[model samples]
Target: MTDTTDPRHAHREEGFPAQQQDQPGLTDETRPDPDHGESTYRGHGRLQGRRALITGGDSGIGRAVAIAYAREGADVAIVHLPEEQKDADDTLALVRAEGRTALSLAGDVRDEDFATRVVTETRSALGGLDILVLNAAYQHDIDGFESLSTERMRRVFDTNLIGMLFTARAAFPHLEPGASMIVTASVQAYQPSPGLIDYAMTKAAQVAFVKALAEEAGPRGVRVNAVAPGPIWTPLIPATGWDAERLATFGEDTPLGRAGQPSELAGAYVYLASDDASYTSGAVLPVTGGKHL
Candidate 1:
């Protein structure tokens, strides 16, 4: 467990520490702080009596949102890939510590059947559903587009775009009026990345889907929105192809001169899922360190 009270772990003006070359080993503490402001973010129970399902809630921004949602009085169901069980467990513990019921489900979002099963289980376990967060994503770094194989591109699209659609569709039936759907897009959606062509394309598609879905569901009172984040230090940084040097310089080029923390993105999700954003839908909130997009 991380010491959330540590100033070094808090959302410092200097941001989270960059990866250290001298330290080859990385622990939870060394990883960027995912849960920030837990001791201080006072929730007025905006999501009181509501239930939420968050994909990829195992870590990164998803974990942050889970904690915040719990604080805001909403029970949470977290879905993660099988390999992310440890991170998922950590998030579940945080939710439970917040005095909210938490459900941890492990499955690949690429499978539509699995997505449907997760929704069914979450609704059954949580008793109802009022918010759905599409946050699971997959990426692989290829130095060039020509080097990207068709199979890899398919996998990226399946997990990043298709999976999100399936999850939303599965949850749609159970979502009532006033329910909200939030998708995790990426800054790559607006700013194309040559090396990450497939991943960026899928993210762009996600934004379009959010807009269209919001329009279609508007009459039904379900709002759909997206959060496009910039560089954020997470396990994905190491899991993906980013080298140590790149990780060390993460977000230094952004106007903020630092990458964002998962905690910084949590409030956006809470606001979108809560009644505070009642009139807001089909909107894209960019937490990209002031990237011009």
Candidate 2:
């Protein structure tokens, strides 16, 4: 007999309950807390003995990936804003539960110094680095392009793009052959939204960064790739300043008729980081819910 489950109704298919949180949202505050695959993921030594540094790993997709990486046998270090220490602690504890070394570095990725330093810190703590998940990001909705403040635009670019560059540049020398760098790009790169104009712009730039860097990193036996996720239920969603109605129907427009869960994206990261993808580089694997990238 074969097991069958409907994809549309698999995890969460109904609209989300209206909720909101401040920037750099907390996992505890998100209603109907997002799943990080704690109970479902079963690893088979896919990433054994690897050391990874994941930015924005305090919560959301970053946290999910951290948990998955740890379970897959990777010592993990996560970077987050000092304000997110509580969330970071929870994620670290989860990593530790897997009996793997876990490090949490609290600092704003927007700071060039901090961004670069965290890479060194992770390497020192983990002994070496083999996987770099450049997943830190920030986004906010705009009422209109005219109303988008220069401050907000700068913050978006700094956190999402500059931070990525700082950490990647710092990791290059430490990355040996077979090292993998995975950027958390987004479906927004392909489909832009007016309210998230600045955020979308940064995401699009990330895709370009992945492609260009892959050309440079590939010849060194290092793989550079990206996972472009569609509408997923993460703290970033509620905190993006969406109206209640918009929040309720957040991902209903997807062909899947539902938003994705962070857990659903783990396999893509794992596959890209593992030798299974030895021949894969300069690729943008879309985890979008039936959305084309």
Candidate 3:
């Protein structure tokens, strides 16, 4: 009998070392670099000849999806902040390793012009766009909801919602029948966390975005969906300004008793982006390690 890896121990199950980084953390700065499925994923042309654009694709969950998409035969274009140049290069290299076209676009998604430009750039560079992954986001723990300043709140809202809207709006006109748009939502949307209340608001809004857009795009043959993840270990986690103790025990409360790695999310994204999920749309597929959505 083929030995199937136990889900409970599929990836790192231990607590993380206490650490932190400035916002938009780089992969190298992360204590244990996230797994982007470099050596493990094997694709069978699920996305052959497809073109995709992933925001925040320099590292973390975005990078994982980029790797999986490339292996599945999709040419990829990744949008990221200029500070993530190093990580972007690394992701580009991995995609090119699969002989897929890789384009690195550096810009802040918070800028509406840039967000719109990325879709244009991806379409131009990749010849056409078939997939758009709205995965860019920002989150900082709030000590007290009363102290949530307008500036910080705006940053979270702009990055998580406005930026996503800008990109999606720009891509809609270009999207043809059969194209797909996937949002990277969070479990916090359903089960709100006091510390991440603002972030949760945006994620919940994303669910509405997916559902409402699905209705509008369905007739056009385009699909809109979301993937709500649990406590996945990514650069975003270290950069969330959590206390060392909190960082160490992150995601341990989950049913799996461990944090998820970026690699683990690759399959969910690949399925949603591929023809395998042809009939799936307006759905929020949860990758939360058994966490109830």
How well does model 1 score by local distance difference test? 0.82
Per-residue lDDT value at 241 in model 2: 87
lDDT of 2 by residue, 1-293 (tens): 77997778878888888888899888898988899898898887899999999999989899889999999999999999998999999999999999999999999888999999998899899999999999998899899889999998999999999989999999998899999999999999999999999999999999999999999998899999999999989988888888889978978999999999999999999999999999999999998889988
In the range 183-202, model 3's lDDT, one tens digit per residue, is 99999999999999999999
Least well predicted 10-residue stretch by lDDT in candidate 2? 1-10
lDDT of 3 at 219: 96
lDDT of each candidate versus the true structure: 0.82, 0.92, 0.94
Show where candidate 2 strays beyond 4 Å: none
Instruction: Estimate the TM-score for candidate 3.
Output: 0.99
Model 1 over residues 83-123: C-alpha lDDT tens digits? 67777888898889979999999998888899889999998
Top-scoring candidate (lDDT): 3
Estimate TM-scores for all models: 0.89, 0.98, 0.99
Minimal lDDT window, size 10, model 3: 11-20
